[model samples]
Target: MRRSSDLSPEIAEEAAWWRDAVFYQVYVRSFADSNGDGVGDLEGIRSRLGYLELLGVDALWLTPFYRSPMADHGYDVADPRDVDPLFGDLAAFDRLVADAHEHNIRVTVDLVPNHSSDLHEWFQEALHAGPGSMERARYVFREGRGFDGSQPPNNWTSVFGGPAWTRVPDGQWYLHLFAPEQPDLNWEHPEVRADLEQTLRFWLDRGVDGFRIDVAHGMAKPEGLPDMDIRPQAPGVLSDDVHDPRFDNDGVHEIHRMIRKVLDGYPGTMAVGEIWVKDDERFAAYVRPDELHLGFNFRLVQAGFDADAVRSAIEHSLAAVAPTGTPATWTLSNHDVVRHVTRYGGGAPGEQRARAMTLVELALPGVIYLYNGEELGLPNVELPDWALQDPTWERSGHTERGRDGCRVPIPWEGTSPPFGFSTAVNTWLPQPNEWDHLTAEAQLEDPGSMLSLYREALEHRKSNAGFAGEELEWYGAPAGCFAFRRKGGGLICALNTSGASVPLPPGKVLLSSGPMDGDQLPPDTAVWLV
Candidate 1:
């Protein structure tokens, strides 16, 4: 409930800093660009340290900056131990970590263990080393099932689109659960396990506080790579209710167990899995004491602005992790999904709903992650078709517009498209002209702006003694409204999604998402009372 300044860095250093840490996910490629390359880099993040420190976040969960060909925007890591030249060199990364710690902000990086870029040395060698070779054993390489081995080995589909199997020139096929350029690894192989261990040590040696494991539900595939029993979902959606044999296999926990053992060697470091698991008990397994420290529960993100849906997501998210004595990791938007503002309704209504949801998310117990531009109330950009670069764009034959909408570069200081994001002619993804008012510079001066609300809310969350406690006590509300109080803290957070304003509970008002009606909490508004 307190920041490093109030809580003491020594205590965070000695204890599990992640327990109550609020992480701001830095989608590095779209955060800022220091070299005018049109793409963000490590140095850009370092330059913004003052801004982040001012914002009062405990840690930065950065997306991959590893050596890559940009096939899947750095998720397709080519060299696990090296920084991509597109970003700065190893020295830049080292400096970012050191400077961040100086700002009392720990840094956590993304680790893609489920797969690697097709250009990775291991995969490149596997492509030409011939079938049955030791090099091929590092990845999932199998013979095609057709008579002449021309067809794919199985009916499994890629998360991006089409067949998951990509045929090699030698009649053998390899598995890539994502794009063809990113091949899945054979987690059963000792070499693959050792290589992941090496990557972990390499980054930890450079002082990274932790990792946000990419596709943590993957890595271990079922034996024989069995065909999934369910129908296909819309492109890029894996809500877990779809029982796909391609992921969440029983074997995956063993990989997490191995990861935990490695991370345990580095005290105060943690691992939170990007787990897309749905079933309660199955999802809980990932966060067992011996496995991952936390797992991302996307229910909140998937839940729309409905009161019932939101409540169910909170209840389920909390219940799932209770068995393991782990806190639920909650988030409203991410690099992979549409920005929540647009999802809530879009336009002024969307902005109001998004702000209300933020109060709900921040008030909840446990660790919460905020996307880079969320504090400013940035909505998704509807990019032109030619501007799309996500693999799913081409893989799905342009049938689905991928996640580029939410990945637009954030507005820092200007009133234009680039918005001080880059000196280049354009950003990697274009920002909307309407975002001029939402720029960090503009909102910084406005006491009523979205950024100010976030700043004030975070300040209260840190300074107010009422933000303490691990669970909430629900209170009955009007048909379209809901209320809850943090158990020990006695802080009441009430939201009114109803048609009319409601009487406020008795307490000193701490903050509200919007203007209240005298003593009443208005529709689409949330209030924190202590």
Candidate 2:
């Protein structure tokens, strides 16, 4: 860790705790079960703090544990202040925060500000109040009957599928960018913004170090409600309005400015926005210093293993944010997306390829998020058709298997029932039978395991202060290789993405992806030369 006094004047100004932080994202449903209720809870996560500390992550990003109706997982929060009963209430959350701090790990919970569950008391009241009521103004409500009472206000499509607008039985239409159950909030309302600010204060006062804002770009919508041109990709599948300017309008900047103002009152509290945009330039706008502290890099997740693709993404990201004073954050996988192991490694050579891919992500120029099972080199579990619980499966006509496979419980103990996650009658998601061989306990004992490699890579990253906040200069390399220098404090990292010995660029080898023996790197490895 770089001490405050050790930081150079330029780096010191940008030296926030998250600059070099390694964040571990935990999907609460699959992490661990404390009461054996077949579901992971706050206490379950608390129990695993030592293991997380051992892995050397700077912080833990817990997916929604707040009160919800389980629509879109927990993103449709019904009550922001209270913890869900299934996740063990407010007291258990307090304990989890305290325990993590004891282990020198920071805690950041998911904050879904864009919408609220239909079952929420406020939404329920809005439903009864009809249009023109003060409570109804809290959400977006169109004053009119639907087209033939069947179509929505506009032709916009929901992210999950179908129309973005839904009509209440009372003859009013409302907008929902994602799922119908999650009604979008009206950010234009002063009360709504004030209420959200209070919610932030409530958690900050409770000792949360920061938050990972969910679907942040969807907070604002175009006021004109223009019709989106239809371009049906699949039969009955529309892709036109999907990128409609009205959907993710420029008004989001105002919303971000308001959020940053709230964050200003609480120092050292970080907010990372989940901006899902294809254009790097537009995505970088969300990360300006006055806006969000970090904007998620979905490019890395979608890059796969193509050397040229990876290079373009890194270079584009750096250029996109150069005008803004915000730093970049990279991730290979997350709860909503397909697992990196399965996405990048789909065939017989998947394992070796995944090993090389990890090195590529770690050597990037920003904070990196490591998914739970990635360090263990776990592949996506193939769940039976009947076992899948993800709403995406049903929503997408089963075209995609949905995220249930990746969301399965994390195996902690080898040869244990439910993989030691729960002792209840059954877990929400069943653990794979192969978990016996893939458990953390099994891999921790093996030095050649992916888990051990992750430890070494992380330690190497921390030891090199130059790599933390220094600017990256990309160097041209072979077709399957990438080299970058973090040229300060005398540190340079050159990574080889291929499975063969490549010529070294001259410095002592600091870390390697594969086996290391007396300064020699194994094939298909990455080496940090210092």
Which one is best on lDDT?
1
lDDT of 1 by residue, 1-530 (tens): 12234445565566477987899999999999999989999999999999999888999999999999999999999998999999999999999999999999999999999999999998989878999999999999999887888878889888888899998888899999999999999999999999999999889878898999999998888889887765757443555542788888989989999999888777778999998877888899999999999999998988878777888899999999999899998999999988888898888999999999999998999998999999999888889998999888899899988899999998998878789999987888888888889999999989999899888888888888898899889998887788999998999999888878999888878899999899999999899988
Clashes of each: 0, 0
Highest TM-score model number: 1
Number of clashing pairs, model 2?
Answer: 0
lDDT by residue (tens digit), candidate 2, 1-530: 22334446676554388876899999998898999889999999999999998888999999999899897778889999999998999999989998999999999989998899988888899999988899999998885545565666777767666677888887788988768888989888898888888888888889898889988777787767777766543321112223765445788878888788777666667889887776766777788778898887666776767666777787776776777866678887788776777776654356666776777677766678888888877777788898887766676677756677778888888596587788775788777676687788988878878788788777767776646554776667765777777756445555555666557666877666666545444455566766
Question: Whole-model lDDT, candidate 2?
Answer: 0.77
Find the number of clashing residue pairs for candidate 1.
0
In candidate 2, the residue pairs with backbone N, CA or C atoms under 3 Å apart (3 or more residues apart, or in different chains) clash, namely none
Estimated TM-score per prediction?
0.97, 0.91
Q: After TM-score superposition, what is the CA distance of residue 437 in candidate 2 from its true location, in Å?
A: 2.1
Position 272, candidate 2: lDDT: 90
Q: Which stretches of candidate 2 lie over 4 Å from their true place?
A: 1-15, 143-149, 229-243, 465-469, 489-491, 495-501, 515-524
Model 1 segments more than 4 A misplaced: 1-13, 234-236
